[model samples]
Structure formats: structure tokens, C-alpha cells
Target: MASPVDTPRNSPSPSPEPDNPYPVETVLTVPKFKRGWAKGARMAFFEARVPDYTSARAKGPAQTADYLVAVSNAYCQQFTWWLDPPNEPTASDLAKTDDELDPAELQLKAAKILRLRRASRNLLDRLSNSAPAISKMTPAQIKRDPVSSLISAIANGKTHVPRARTAYQLWSKSQFNKDIKTDVDQSVIDNGVDAKSGRIRLVTGSTQQAFQNLPASERRVWELQADAEKAANQEARGLQKKDGVIPAMPLDPTATQDMLDALVHKIDPLLQGISKLTNGNAHFYWAGPEPRRGGQINVISMHAGVDRMPIPCGFMEAGGSEGVARRRTVEAAIGDFALSCYDPKVQAARTLPKIAPCSAPPSFLRYRPTTWDAGNTESPSAHSQPSTDNGLISPPDVSLPGNPTTSSNQSPSATTSKKSSKKRKSNTDAAAPPAKRHATGVRTNTNDEDQTSDDEPEETPWQVDDDGSGEDEPANSQPRRSGTRTSMRISTKTLPPQHDPLDDITNTVHMSSSDKLPSPEIPDNVAGAQLTDDDTMNEGLDTLNAPTTPATASTPVSTAPFLSNPTIPADLPKYLTHVLPKFETLAEPAWQDVTKSFVKYEVSRKFDDVRLQTGNRPAAAVQWSRLRRPLITPDKLPREMPQTVKLAAEAFWRWWRHLQPSWRNVNASANALGDIDRNITEEDWERLDASGANGLVNVMGYLWLWGMKVGVSGEGCQDWEAALRDVQWALEKMTAATNV
Candidate 1:
């Protein structure tokens, strides 16, 4: 229970009263919250239910981010159960946290909002490109299947995919267009758009680079393209003289980048529905640097549960000299067919149980140290873990009900479970999968080692070091990171020295060039090299066809273990894999109702008298047999399954009602209250009957399944590229099929 102080706290303030009163002025002084006020406000502005995203704007000599100002004032005082101490960045803090800003600082909510916005713009741009070239095209063309349109565009070398575009474009492209002053989208191709005589036209050689795949040069090109596009758009409008033809304008390559992130904000609701559908919330996160790297794009789409963790469904790389060239393709490449949006595969249950790593450029794995808790402990800076296995490294269920300590043998052992259930009858089989992907949003294709190799040194195009000499570092001294912005530097050895001697990377013998000096002696004990010949031979064997290992391994392992990726790979850029996933994790809570429910549950029942008077059952117990169904008999109990089994199965609901002790008096007081209507979605009740691991998995599964139904879904397997097409198809088909 934290209370605020009237005095502004520059450092640690005196502890507040236990009342944890939501004091207006004093609570705002909490140091932990001070840092994130602006960011939180921005998130809340969009997250809070509203008539529209923006508030009414008023003219002002001094403009401010209304959202940020509110957050700084509201959450500034005490630390909430869900929020860690404040790390809010102020204008001055931004100057201090310039280059060294930790990527982790840009939490999930912020990241997701960014992803949503970026993705929306990117999707629109794509649709703009593939729209009917002639504004007055036939209805058939205007209403062509979006997924098919995207596929056709991809197959026919069209510049972009067709997703949901503006209604103006849709109507104008249709034969019905007459006097509507619809503007053509120059960022994307003007497919069926009638060549507006007064508009400017621009040429753009676009590429779909993976969020993590683009080189720095390519990323910069993307940024420049975005800025230039903005400039072009501004100039185009102004170019309209009394009677001139449309100005010729080049397209903005940046407009279609993988920055496909969520522009909208989603806030967690207290006592809100848990395990809601996942569709309308699919978002793409672009990892940010410490100093406010950038925004993410979001969407709602169906995805293979745990399996989706292994595939970067929206990844692509192209046309950049450095950094990442491609922007995230939100729902593209999945062949987003309208009907396919209802694909049975989209309904399957799959959850990695936790945030997992994206298996992209090998370097991204570094952020997820082998220990799931490494660098994530209460005292993150104090813990320095030794790097061990490259294979998945699961952790003890630290977030479980009990204080799951770092020590292992005393962890969630099978022995404790048997002892706890000794008095009760129990039997079980909760199978586990072979390996789990990390919470990070990266996945390397086991079948596509060549994908990593395609951009290798041999086929390499432009050199970051324009001079033939690969010495990219400045002749004088390397530039120090000022804040979040740092110039790109291509490492000489893009791939880690960890390639197996027998794998595709095994072509170890390199021709020593007279121009290039030898690198330092390769360490014999390098992790990749430490493996035995047998291990090297089986290089990708662990991921390619790893057998599913049952979770019933006597001890429950936290599913999303971090990988210790050591260095950046030349072929892969750091931004895509190295930094993006953290943003996703921060955003996860908003997309769902985890934290809010837990916080609310903590404060519930503890003092609520209604709960005391009426325990779990109603005052009078109605025969469950007559009301619902008869309980399983003792004989059947042995065979009956459990809906949920705890691994790290730890969380909560409304606290004010649940924890507080209630009065036993039969007569109710006027002040007596009951926290009713704990949101029970269809997904919830169905999971109620499920026991053990099935419960958690199925709950998450239904959420995702429903999500796809609402967001990204199509009939069959949606490859990364075609998914967006399906989304467009779904939106359009649904829109057209509507009687409106």
C-alpha cells in the first residue's frame, strides 16, 4: 500500500502509509513512476476507451503531448503492483539516455502501439499500390480478392500487396467513381487508380526486408524514404497549380517498411475478461533502442499457437545496403483469402506459455540469456550468468505461487507434487514438447539454412565501407554512442565463429587474401566448436525435427527459455531479431488481461463481507447434479482429466473482493459489496473442465483461435508473405458482403 507525498521526490522518498491510498498529489512523487509518465500517458490515451483515438485539439502557442502530461501526473506517485519502479524518461532524461538506452525500456505497451501504427500505415500503403490502376476500373477489379490480389502482385512483380486501403480508393477505383475527389496513394502503386491529372507520380523499387534482416544502410534508406515520402506528399499537394498535370514523384520506400507495428494503444482492464480472442490484436513490434528507437505496428490475425513462435510469419528482406531494408509485412504472404481466414488450422491451440524469442538473425538470441531469469532478476544488474547451452534453456517456475528460488533441486520437483496431493487421489500425464522457442519474436527456418546463407559474403551487394578496404571503423577513434542513435558499423565477421565444421557453415576453408589479414586465432573452446563431431553433424537437428518432450518430466520447466546469442551476424541485422521481441512482451499484457486481473484479484475478497457471508458457494447449496451435471464418481475420478496444472501457473484476479475478509453476519450492511461478474467468456468455462497443462494451453489456444477468427485468418496454411492478402480479402469481403 503506497501513498503519495506532496513534496517532489528527486531521489528515493520516505515510505508511504500502508493504506496505499490513491492520493492524487503525493502518489505522483514515486520515483519509479516518474520516468514512464509520458510514455504511460501516451499508452493510456489510446488504451482508454474513447470515441476516437484523438482528443479534441485546441490551438496553443506551446504544444504538449496531452497524453504524456496526464501519465506523468497520474502514475507519478507510488509503484503499482504491476509496475516496477519508475524509469520514466523526461526531456532531460532523454538527453542522458541518448545512445545507451536499454532496448528493454520500451515496454510492450509502447512497442505494441508503435507496431500497430506502423503496420496500419504499411498495410494501407500496400493496398494503395495494388489498387486498381485505373480509378474507374470495373467493380470486378475494384473488388478483386485481396489475398489473390496480393498473391498476383507478388507473382506478377507488382510493387506491393493489396490489403485494406482507404474507402476513397476503394470507391474511386470502382466504376462508380464520378465526382469524388479521392487522392491517389503515391507510396504504394496506383494500380486501378485513375491517373489523377493533378497529382504527382513517383517510382519506388520496393523490397520486403525482414524487421531484423535489413542492413543499417538499408534501414537508413528506409528512414530517408519515409521522410522523403512525407516531403513528397507535402510537396505534391502544394504542386497543384491552376492547371498543370500531376507532378512526377518518386515513392517512399520507407512507407512500406517492416516497422509494421501497432499504432493503437491497448490497456489492461481490471476484472476484465481473461483469455479473450486474439484476432483484432495481432501486432508487429519494432525493437527500440534505449533512447526511444521507434514505433511498432499492430494487427489482429489468426496464428498457429506455439508453432507461430517458430515462424516469423511476416518476415522478408530486400534492397537495403545496411541495417534492415524491409519493413515488417503485417498480414502479407499468408495468402489472406477471405474464406481461409476461417481455416481449421487457425483454430489449433498453441502457446509457448511465455514470450519466446524470434529465431531470426542468430544475434537476436543474445538478449535472451540462457537463463530465463538472467538479467531479469529482482536485481538485474547484480546477476552475471555464465553462458552454457545453445539448446533451449528452461527455468524453474519462478513466478509460481510459492517463492520459486534460483536454487534448482528444491524447485517444482515431482516429489513435492506427490507429497502435496498425497492426501488426495491423483493421476496424470501432461506431455511436454521437445523444445520451446523463446519469447522473442524470431524464428530460424530449420528447412532454410540457405536463407541465412543467401545474403552471405559471396552474393553481398554494396559495401558499407565504400572504400574497398573493409576497415569500417573510423581511422581515428570509433564514435561513442551518444544516445539511442548510433551510426551503423558492419562487423568484419558477420557470422559468429560458431558455425559447425560439418554444416552449411562448415565450408570452413577460406582463401586467405593478400589484401585481408587473418582474424585473431579462433578459439578452440568456442561454444559452437565445443560440441563433439556428432553434435556438429546434427547441427540443426535439435530444431528441425526435435521430438516433442512431454511436460511431465517430473519437473515443470518454464517454456520460454532465453537463448544466449553471442554476436551479430553479417547476414542478419540486429534490429529485426535482437531488439523487437521485448516490445512484444511489454505489449502482451494490454493485448490480454493478465496484469489487470492479477492486480484486482490481489485487492479483492480480502475485506469484502459479501465473500465472507457467501463463500465459494451460494448461501444455500443447490444440488449441482440437478443444476448442472453430476460429478464424476470415485471410480471415474481416477480417470478424469484436470483442466489446469500449474507449471509457473501463477496469477490472480480482483484483490479488493477476494483477499479481504468479509463479515459472517447474515444481515447485509448498506456498505456491504460483492465483486460480481468476473468476466467468464466461453473460452473460460470450456477451460474450466480441462485439467492440468491442458487448461492453460487450451485457454491460450482458444484465445488465439478466436483471435484469428477476428483478425488474420484464411482457409489453409498461410505463408508469411500471403497472410496480409488474406487480411485484406477478409476485410473487403466482409465489408462488401455486408448489407450496408
Candidate 2:
């Protein structure tokens, strides 16, 4: 017997779409300055859209290069020539008119700064006034949930790709898809997708929850239903029996590495990241809302589970609001544009405690708050940067409106934990000591410093422990793991129901009622995680059943190039096995099936049926949510660096080798595992529980974490809160399966 799957688990309990979109989130307002700003950068990234970028069009990419460099410089300087002191007028200082410079010299920076300025008045604006409600996401969910990372096949190639399609059926298995055999893990994939939700669910909690949700917990005796269905689903290659091609099972992963490379890397990046498709304006590599402030000059396109590119922003010109028309004129001439919703810099700047106008900081604070807290430590009056509670280990809110948690309100579903840290010392720099200490465990260091003060008791006095500030709201709770998400167009509908969905714009954890209450003190890098490898990387799952790899040997992902690039992206939290907590690895026999009878794996639609009020999302977001996991087909771990992605693959193998209890890991759908629990009987459940669930949830956590780091953030994949939430959800599902 198998388990149940083939759709999102335990969701679709509808009330009205929660009207209030904006949720409360921690906002770190920083004063940009010269030296220490970049440490915990003050930069704000916006998932926004802008209109005409004619000025930038006049400049173009070739011409945009020189200006882009100038913008980076201008922000750092205080110039009287410009209306604002912080605004660097150096780029334009070189030329009185746009034509004075060589068209070939233009860079994206100049255009990015100039274009976004045209959209905004001042660089320092508070874009996201309210925090948006966002739940944690698994790597799989982020990759598959593309409501914003939409890019269309530009017929004319002049304007931005239009949003022609809305919904797509995404597979949950795609996120952790390690095997590169190409054909969608026909058996495994079919296990999760639901033709109705346009999403695939393989090993899900929905069915189990159906029984678990009964008012009488004792009444919930689980049964093995979906697992057999999936076993039947995985019965054949492509799983095409007399039914012709099944609606759920699609023959995927057939394309050569070359085709994938072309589509995943070249085309996707250029179209969304560097392309001038959106009226010469910049667009996010993935998808989301518009900027709260300054606009985007460069286009960013991101793919799930893989790669990312950085996004740059510029300050709005003084009296920017009044000069909107003129700004557009200039932007259009030079082809400069800003990203939507990013204008938060503008809003935040306005709200930020005005320090000496001369002492502003640099931008990196948007993604990392540790530095922001450091800054506050140095400045007694650090109003710009706010406070957070680090003691509680609150997880992202996974409960959607209709889907009451298993215990209902009896137990809060999520628990918050401090950021995970590798056992190794800070490889980047020495951590700051805690400034003050409390018996209850509260500590504070400067939130305005170059480095975050470690509050971990074991560290030092300079460290500051924080209880994350952001909290999820009741109405528009971030979309839960098992539910569908909604996205609307910005040009026309950007401001429809409310503001951004995430409450705190920056990354921070939220504590819940049920979470283990922390002492007054909390520290950074506290998740004492460990890594265990599966023996199969060097040994064997089966010589015949090996993993797959990219076919085109021409291009390989090199460690050298990645390390050299200042922007070398780290694989998401998944690969960061150094810090995983309570993790006992799940293993598999080395998949020896090198039979790369490649199938072109496009994110197949489970329900080729109608996509309606059913959580219709933007195509851009859908595109960004799907991560590509090319199967590894290697020999004795290639002695030399290959042309394709090497380091990540190597690290993956090394980690695989560390599995604690070598598992002949089957690519079993979640449903199958559930059946093993159910049919086995209560005694079996008890035995399995005692023997250990192998920390399956922990495995999912690492995978989700790795996924986030892989892509340049803002590519719709690097939401830390989402990653944490997904891990918790996975844990709950796994725990339930083991107990039943």
C-alpha cells in the first residue's frame, strides 16, 4: 500500500480573501553614512514595477554602464551642486547632456539611479509603511509559487512581457528534486499535484489532517489510501498506461543540459534581469509588488532552486514628486527606470530619525538586520533602526484562515528560533560583544554598528540578544505551505485591497505563544545544527540506479568563477549543513541509474483544466518559484573541475556521504511514508517513533535553506521567514506521519 498525495494538503478553507493586505513587520530605518553603512546594509530591495523608461531607452545598456558606476559613487558623496548633499552628481558631472558620453560606455547603474529617481522625489523615502503578512515558505514552495516572477515570450521584444497567463500547476517535489533523470519523478511528482489547485502534492498532511481535525483527536485513526494510488502512479516510466498520458504524470527532464542552460540561465536572466523589456524600466529577477520608493534601473530574472543576480537602487531626486514629468522625460531619454514597491527607501528615509544630514549609511541593511542592530549600539539615539526579540524561537505562521492547526488554537503551530550558525567561528569577522545583560536574558548592543554583536552567552559581552520584532496577523496570514497564494498586477491593481503583504520588510523571526519562551537573553547563530552524510555518494544505493547530470559537457558550474565573483551566490540554507539542529540524515543507496534518457522537464500542469478563482498568480512569480535540480551523473567525483555546476554538486555529495544512518533512500512520495506509518498499526507507529523519524523535517529545512541562498535574493526565492516557516510545516507533517 502507498500513501495519499497529488495536491496541497489541508487548505482552501475560504472566508473572504483577507481584506487587509499589509501586516506588521520589523522595519529597520537606517541613516546611510560613509564607512560603516555597508556592513548591515541600509539598502531596501523592492519587488516593484514602473512605467516608461524612455530616458534610459535613450541611453540603453551599452550607455547605461558608465552611469551605473557613477550612481554607486554619487550616493556616498556630499555634493552642494546637487539639491541634496548625499546625492552624488558625479556621473552627470562628466556630461552636461546625455549625448556627451559614449553610448558604448553606458552601464545599468546610471540608468538605474536616474530612472528610479524619476519615479521618486528623494532617495530616502519609507516605502513600506506597514508590514506585509508573509508566512514562511519551503524552498519547494518559493520555487513553485510564481505569482510575481513572470516573464512572457516578448513577441515584439520592445515592451515588457505582458501577463497573458495567470495560473500554473506547480509540483512540490520540484524544490528538493535532486535526481536529474529528467522525467518528472513520474511516480513521486504525481503523488502531490492536484488538478484542481493547479499544484501537485506527493507527501502531504492534507489527508491526515482531515482525520486529525476531528473534534475528537482519538477518533482520528489514519488509513493508507493515497500511498497505493501513487504506487500505482509510479508503476511505469512516464506512468502512461491505458489512460494515455495521465493528467498528473508528465514526461519531463528530457532536455539536454544545453537546452536547460539556454532557458534557465541565458534567456531567463536577460529577459528578466538585464533586458529592457519593461519599457526600459527595471524589473525584479522574479516577481512581487512595486517599490515603496526609488525605482529599478536593471531588470532581474530569478529561477527557483538555482541562481540569482543582484539588484541596485538609486535615491530619488530632491523635490522628486514635483518633478515627476521631467524625471520621466530624463529617464526615458536615458532608459533609466526603478522597480516598484522598492520606493520604501524613499518612505523609510522620510520616517528615519534625521541624524546629522551629513552622516547617512550605505545600503546593505535591507536583507540582514544584524548589522542594523550593531549600528544602533554605536549610536545611543538609533531611532532609525528598531528593536526585535531574539529570545523566542517563533516559527513562521503556517495556519491559513480555513486550515486550523492540528491542535487548533490549543497550541500555536509555529515556534521561533534564532538564525542557525555553523559550529565554526564567524568566518567573516569577529562578532561584537553584548553591551548590556539581563537575568531574564535581554541584551542590547548597538544596532547601528558594522557588525552584529553576538548575544550568545558563550560568545562575549559585545553581543546583543534580540527577540524578533515582526509578528504575523490574523486576517491575511502569509500563505500557508499547503494553501494557494494570490497575486494581482501592479500597473492597474497594485494598490487594490491594501499595501504589501509582508509586515516587516527586512528579514526577522517572529515568536508565537506556544514557542519555548526564551530567557531575557537570545543570541545569534544559536541553532546548533549538525550535518550527516549518506554513504551513497562514494558507496552505493545501487550501481544501476545512479543520479543524473547535465548532458552538455561544454559548460559547467565552476567554483572558481563563483568565488571570484563578489556576488558569488551561496546555495540556499539547504546546503548550509554546518548549523542544522537535531538533524539525523535520511539516506539513499547511490542511485546508479545513470540512464539519463533525458525528458524535457517543463513545470508540467497537473490540472490542464481551467485555472480560475483558484489562486491565479502572476506568470513572473510562477516562473521564479520553480528551481532546477539537474541530476548528478559523476564518476569517482570528477578529478578535475567540470564545465557545469561543480562546487554545489560536490558539496551535495560530501553532505550525502555524512548521513548518520545510511538510508536506502527511496524517492518515496510523502503519501507513501504516511502509509508505512498507518498500515503498520499503532504498535508499529510507537516503534517507528522510538527508532526515530530520522529528523525528516530537518532534512527539509536544510533543503529549503539551500534553495534561498542559491538565487540572488529578490529573485523570489530568498525569503528567510518563508524558509523557516516551511521547515516547521514539514516537521509537523513528518511528525504526524510518524505518530500515526
Report the error of model 2 at residue 728, Å. Answer: 56
| Candidate 2 runs further than 4 Å off | 1-252, 256-261, 271-472, 475-740
Error of 2 at 712 (Å): 36
The C-alpha stretches of model 1 lying farther than 4 A from their native spots are 1-74, 78-234, 239-661, 664-740
Question: Over the stretch 681-723, how does candidate 1's per-residue lDDT look in tens digits?
Answer: 1222211222121112222222222222323233222221122
What's model 2's lDDT at 560?
Answer: 23
lDDT per residue for candidate 2 within 1-740, as digits (tens), equals 11111111111322222331111122332223332222112232110101111112233432222222223333323221122222234544633433443454333323333333322312222221211111222344335542212221111111121122111112223323343222333544566555224333432333233334545533422122234333544563233333232122221122111122223232333433343343333322321111211121222232211123142111111111111122222222122123223354442332212321111111111112222233345666432322223221111112211112222111110111122211122222235532322222222222212233333223321123232212212222333344231111112221113212122112211221111111111011111110101001222213122112101111111222212234322321211111111011112111001000000000011111221111111111221111111111223122222222323232223222222121323231211122232222222222111111112222332333333233323342323233334333333333455335
Reference-based lDDT, each prediction? 0.23, 0.23
For model 2, give the RMSD to the true fold.
33.6
Candidate 1: residue 553 lDDT (0-100): 11
Q: Tell me the lDDT of candidate 2.
A: 0.23
